[model samples]
Target: MDKLMPQIESHIDFFLREKLPKSMPMVAMLIGDKTIGQIKEVFVSEISVLFPQLIGQYADGLLEDDRLYPMLTEKLQSAAVYSYISGTQSKLKGLFSKVKWGALVFGLIYGLLIGLIAA
Candidate 1:
């Protein structure tokens, strides 16, 4: 049997190759176009050009399906939220070293107010 073709030739790079090695093999062979679309528009465009047959046939199941988009969007939004929250948590963790106990209480109140205002 022939070895499976690399999904995109002349285009793969180190960062993407790292992410892709973990992709489910069955899913990669089949609906991989829509899978790459979630990564970026550039990947979508490249897949369309490089592997039109597979991507075109499975496009709806992978790309246009309602279930897929919502999950992808939620993942994206939650990543952003988690990133910001982790940064804030790190800052707050460091704050404890600098303030006196009474001042820390005021600082916490001020931090909450600042967060509210920023949001």
Candidate 2:
């Protein structure tokens, strides 16, 4: 685990710096201060859950090579990206819905005002 710390930290840094922004711009914007905190939380949570089992498997020679490390990183990245993208999509949908309602309300008010003036 100690041996893996540096690499894991680097991966986390890379994901936060490069991947998260490109993948989920809305979430990043919505939670500007909390973005890094949320990402680090996810990273720690995932690593804590998986690292022990992974290390055990490596020690038992169950894993063929160090391929699992990269695989694990990819899995973590994918999970984060998926989570953020879903959240962003939901936010966007809600925003669009609100805009639609606002337009409808504005249109109705404008039509009523015109009708009153024309009368």
Candidate 3:
């Protein structure tokens, strides 16, 4: 187990250097939570040669994928699942752009008035 650690690091380094064009961090950040979990599930198979020691960290990371996959699956009903997920931001951009500032202010004021009345 201990010996395989260096081998894993070397393999990852070689992949990052020779195969991946840019840093994985940038790519990973865009992949989202559920897809990341699927990646982990596939990569942790015995054929991948991942060490048992690093398994804890891998499992933890996979489990922490609580970002927004569940919400998107509600609409994905086609063959190009990966493409749909990869293009999530394109369709959902409107959701992030329209901020309910007035509603938020009104809600705050309403809450304050309610608190005052209760007091």
- Tens-digit per-residue lDDT, 60-99, candidate 3: 8867778546645655654487687769967667665555
- Residue 35, model 2, lDDT: 69
Q: Rate the local accuracy (lDDT) of all candidates.
A: 0.65, 0.83, 0.62
Q: Write model 2 residue lDDT over 27-56, tens digit each, in one string.
A: 557655466767777887789779999888
> Which has the better TM-score: candidate 1, or candidate 3?
1
Query: In candidate 1, how many clashes are counted?
Result: 0
The candidate maximizing TM-score is: 2
**Candidate 2 regions off by >4 Å?**
58-119
As for candidate 2, its clashing pairs are: none
Candidate 1's TM-score: 0.25
Q: Residue 84 of candidate 2: its Cα lDDT?
A: 94
- Model 1 agreement with the true structure over 14-51: per-residue lDDT tens digits: 33444455665554455455655556557546656666
- How many clashes does the backbone of model 2 have? 0
Q: Which prediction has the highest lDDT against the true structure?
A: 2
